[model samples]
Target: MVLYKNEPLTGHPCSRPMARECVATLPASYFSDPKVFNLELQAIWSREWIYACHENRLRMTSPLEMTLATFPISLCLSESGSVAGSLNALTGKPDSRRIHTHVLNGFVFVNFSDAPPPFESTHVGLADEFKSVEHVFTEAEFDFWGHLSLPGAFNWKVFSDNYNECYHCPTSHPQFSKVYKIPSYVVDAREGYFVHSVEERQEGGKAAAASNASVTELLLTESNESFPMEAKRLYDESYSALNQKIKEYAKANPPRARAKAHEGGLFVHVFPNVGINVFGDFVTTLRWNPASHEKTLLQLEVFVRKGVSEAEMLRFSNFLKWVEIEDYVLCEATQKNLALGVYQVGVLHPFRENGLVHSQAQIRKRLVEYVSQERELKEKVGKQRDSSTTLSEESGTLLN
Candidate 1:
């Protein structure tokens, strides 16, 4: 089932039970309409568990600050290490909005809704998957170096669609393609979020750890050796310095075998917003917030084990900046094209674009549920009004 350019997919965007083909590209209005955006803001953004920041920020500062659904919320870490999030106000009494907080694996998550699902239940088996990094996460030994915020002219979902899949890496990111086995990348759509993994495929169809090399190993091996001499020299210099740090880290804290065999590094997309990308040695977090129908504010932060060397930290920061810049360019261009009105929808690769597919499905599902609730409330209200009118008319007739 294919849809032509500018042709509408059958059924309303807010309709329940959308066919797979119709969901390939969301209606352009989903990205542009203010009303639809507000519906999503209330339905999905305000209710779901949003990935905010790491606990390290709380350690460095009393109240970790952030914005959610246009509200300026300040999160404070109590003496008990329990996080309390509150909305700020300038005058009058404090706002009465409830801010729910949940901390998992040293990562801070908050929900604007009064209640959200338990983190463990929502995430399914993610805790077991992170058992290998218990020392880094559970011990709170990771340091939050800094964050880079990139504002671009694209809907936040557009950037999400780009980040969730690696299908375009071969043509779009030559440097990334060199290190990552794009064909082997896959996303596991959990109940509330998606987990991505990359692994080399074996002859028997079983997944292996990139031929026994983890992400860090591949980074140290493939990237430095495959690039041109100029790039190679820079990498060699960087590695020569970073190798000392690695040796010290290993000597102090010997590497432990991962509890679970998830093959490559893990990248998690926690519905609607937070993106946590974990490499073996370091982790990069991405926060997506919508500024307008056509604009989004993205914050990218890199974190490493508490005592990582400055040289090694700089390498990860530089790599993130370069790759994210590439993504910004692509997303910005795509946003412009989307606004041109020449193309309203486009087909997605059935196998490769499943991440985008799952995300869109989640979005549509929430919208449908919201719409259904609204409809039911409206009908109930109408019935109450009619009953009240009938009672008034009968009283008047009896009085006459």
Candidate 2:
């Protein structure tokens, strides 16, 4: 489907088109229909290079067994310490076919197809962006903190739709709104991915200071009045112990600050299912694991500098989880509404939700192709059957 945007004619600033063009989202059936989900698995999931994990997770002693888009895969360390993956059958045994695996910037990607598209060419925009900020993701400079997997009762596309735009961020993510300048946030869609960039609110800015004060006040009240006497004592002692550990850890490992391109945040969303979030002191990988049409597992893996304190990391994790939960609620509600017969389609803001527009366009293109292929296959089979019937009739007539 071709979509057009309203634009001013060249050299005629006042000649703006009067017609308002709006991009419509995919039909609601795409979200909850099992048949559409199966088509996506065959066309999009199987052909795309799905992000698996960081190389650090792989060990020579034991292979990592996990499911990617419901396909079981086992990743192992090769003799040269590189990543290798194998597709497993229903019996939990490796099949003769080997899954195609590629490692880029220490992150592993797997494709279930026999002949997958060239990674760099297929993901030109993502590759270029990663190359530009290559210094920030050097494997040796960071440690894998851990991973968080949150299951949701929504389609993977719902999460992708939520991630593709920040229009709802201000109202949906209050804490996040204070930390980042929402007005300046931008999501630029490229060839095969989307880039999200935003500047942080100034450290001493009124908004930042107010947010910090509120958080401090909340923590103090919770620790002091909300807990029982014994619990309060335990909390106080734990806080002190954690502070000491932070100090000791900081002393042992001084901060190794790396130069960044700018004092802003950067995120890349590779089409189908991967996100790379880059921050000042840490990086995270986000994946949407689709189990069914209405189920998805959101996975987040954190990698931080060695000098980051345990307390700080914990706080960051908590904040991330909070934001994710807020999003989950919204997505789940949206999913439920979509499943209802009341709504079949919705309009998208051409500029604000352009990322979502791009994503849906990609999906629509793939499904269209799948439908075309199915039609051709049926036609071919029908022709062969007709030919076989004609030959049998001719043989029987000649014998009579």
Candidate 3:
């Protein structure tokens, strides 16, 4: 499928599905095209929320805040409740909109939102720190030889598009697929999702309160209350606590694990940058290095309870590392393939690819709104969540 930015499906700067038939049928050569890669860059990753880092990166008061492939975007964690991230102003494109936040990712970057600094600065020379860090743009750090490309190759979306579904899981990732089911066109995701929620954390207070009686946890739909509370409130009651309820239900009615191995934790990929995957007892971060168009790197960090044994934690850590190796290998291969051709277009799966589809839709809509002459897409892009899965609901409580 040769994809052009201003073509019919894209309708000048974007295109969409039903045109997706070519996605599966197109050979590897199609996706390898440089022109197609460029089009994908313009349409996808540019404006979408690409997860760069989590709160942990900026921990130390005078620590090096690195952006994978790019140079370090010096982070100053001062005693005062202000975080000043310094970049190499010379290389940074002044006009570029520093990705203050990946609006689509939904979690407002602490930089933009009201997430105040937990600690304070006990130092001086704030301007000097900004002077030292080399920034391509405030969004991306400068790296003479790193992964972040000003127009990162093919855009990280290619990796994300690949991750959203398991259509290729039966073939590509056999090990993990053996333990948990992957949703394809024919199968429903209720089971895969069911397995995790069953094991996930119960809220702060209630669990096993009533083994069999009726309980209902209603999440009142409210917006922008604070971090953690999220959009819905899961006030557990007599009917069911949807988050932990999935676990109790799954256990009583165990969803068949493709195999007996449920070693890993939940990994609900939040597009553009952040992905949360569970491995045993830890939640891992899958971060990408955006140096340039030719290369990108991804890193994983796992967090677990304070008192857990290291050996126990390593069990899932090793497993996730192996799984990540699979993804990284694929991403590298895809990059190689994309670097070769000029017109390959990938299609989004209507089922397993809610994130990909939502991302593309938002991207197309945004491109039409921001770059189009006709101003055909002026509609605002509210935070997009794949309502099909219980992630938003789960994360709403957990993050809060």
Among all windows of 10 consecutive residues in model 2, the one with the lowest summed lDDT is: 10-19
Q: Pick the candidate with the highest TM-score.
A: 2
What clash count goes with each model? Answer: 0, 0, 50
Model 2: CA > 4 A from native:
5-20, 59-61, 91-96, 203-265, 383-400
Ranking by lDDT: 2, 1, 3
- Work out the TM-score per prediction: 0.73, 0.78, 0.49
Tens-place lDDT digits, model 1, residues 24-49: 56766577655666667767787888
Candidate 2, TM-score vs. the true structure? 0.78
> How high is the lDDT of residue 55 in model 3?
39
C-alpha lDDT of residue 109 in model 3: 29
Candidate that beats the other on lDDT, 1 or 3, i.e. the better one: 1
In angstroms, give how far residue 226 of model 2 lies from its true place. 17
Error of 3 at 76 (Å): 3.3
